[model samples]
Target: MAVNYPNGKKFLAESHMPKTTKKKDLIYSNRGMTLEEEINSSNEHYLSSGRAVIHKKPTPIQVVKVDYPKRSAAVIREAYYRQSSTTDYNGVYKGHYLDFEAKETKNKTSIPLSNFHEHQILHMKRCILQHGITFVLIRFSFFNRVFLLNSSYLIDFWEDTMNNGRKSIPLAFIEEKGIDVAYGFNPRLDYLDAVDKLLEHTNK
Candidate 1:
């Protein structure tokens, strides 16, 4: 399939091909860094620096078909999008379990509430009830601004949307209720800083 970039550059980006690595180890690269890549790299940095234990949740996928020629590489012919059963990333941080969903949007004013799934929201609510830290890392690509919005604010508006007629969470509301995560060289989103603040509030 051909994809067109925002600048009208058309090209075809092939899907992942099956390959064997020594010991079946996962490889990390910044060559095509998506938001997911940045978060994973940041988590690695944190783990190495004794900062926190956070990791991206691996979603299990079922391969429907594959084609392999003799003495050649294998290609995935078909696959199904797996349902994510948990938050995007989760682990213990400073004695508290932290759960988060990282998302990006091109919209300049607000993030569409539809970007969040019902199951994902319920998972976060459960975490909050269990005294775990729960929040979302929302990146506004247009502005390069990231905010850590707690689950409480999200669910509040989410439920309200059912009858209140708001389809998206306005930027003003996010600015008022969410903690701004400063982007840095290390933890690209630096969401841990906001986590620290959440921890302080809970401890007080």
Candidate 2:
């Protein structure tokens, strides 16, 4: 007699069966978190604890069309990037304005300058000049490392790029000037540590 599966599929006696995921495996499989997920979670923790108020900026999109499937709901059918964003996040931390762009790179030796935009570089400079806490959070995904790269250092590199020079910032260069952001359970990026360090440097 042939065995028939519940889905109306017949199987031979020597047929290979599909592997089933165990309940334990399921729990562990769903445990890992993405960089964005971790960052957002940390932000929520900070907001609730009254440590700081930081939020990811919403990307403006030009919706060309929308489908009204129901009276109470509408689904965006077409959209386009409105314009370039200056930064990924902005907020007031410890009574000081903070602005930064978060980016991820896979390069092991250097972070390509192309990863950053001209407008963002300009915005960071303006923010710094205006006494805002401006920096970039760079996540070297391949190396599983994160760094708080100061706007000053980034600006210097940006200037060089405009001239005749390397188009990327070497990891060694970043290590020398940038502060390494330690990962933790809460405040995943824990960039405030670097910010505090920057504050000390500026004050001194």
Off by over 4 Å in 2: 1-32, 67-70
lDDT of 2 by residue, 21-88 (tens): 22322455424555555566668778988989998877888999976553323557899987655787
TM-score of structure candidate 1:
0.76
Instruction: Indicate the worst ten consecutive residues by lDDT in candidate 1.
Output: 16-25
Report the C-alpha lDDT of model 1 over 1-204, residue by residue, as the tens digit: 773223322322332333232112245432335566667767877998999999888787889998764544455689888999778999988788999998889999999999899999899888888988888888888787888898888888889997877989998889988899886767655778898987777689
- Write down the TM-score of every candidate: 0.76, 0.80
lDDT of 2: 0.78
- Candidate 1 regions exceeding 4 Å error are 1-33, 63-79
With a 3 Å backbone cut-off (N, CA, C), the pairs that clash in candidate 2 are none
Which one is best on TM-score?
2
Best prediction by lDDT: 1
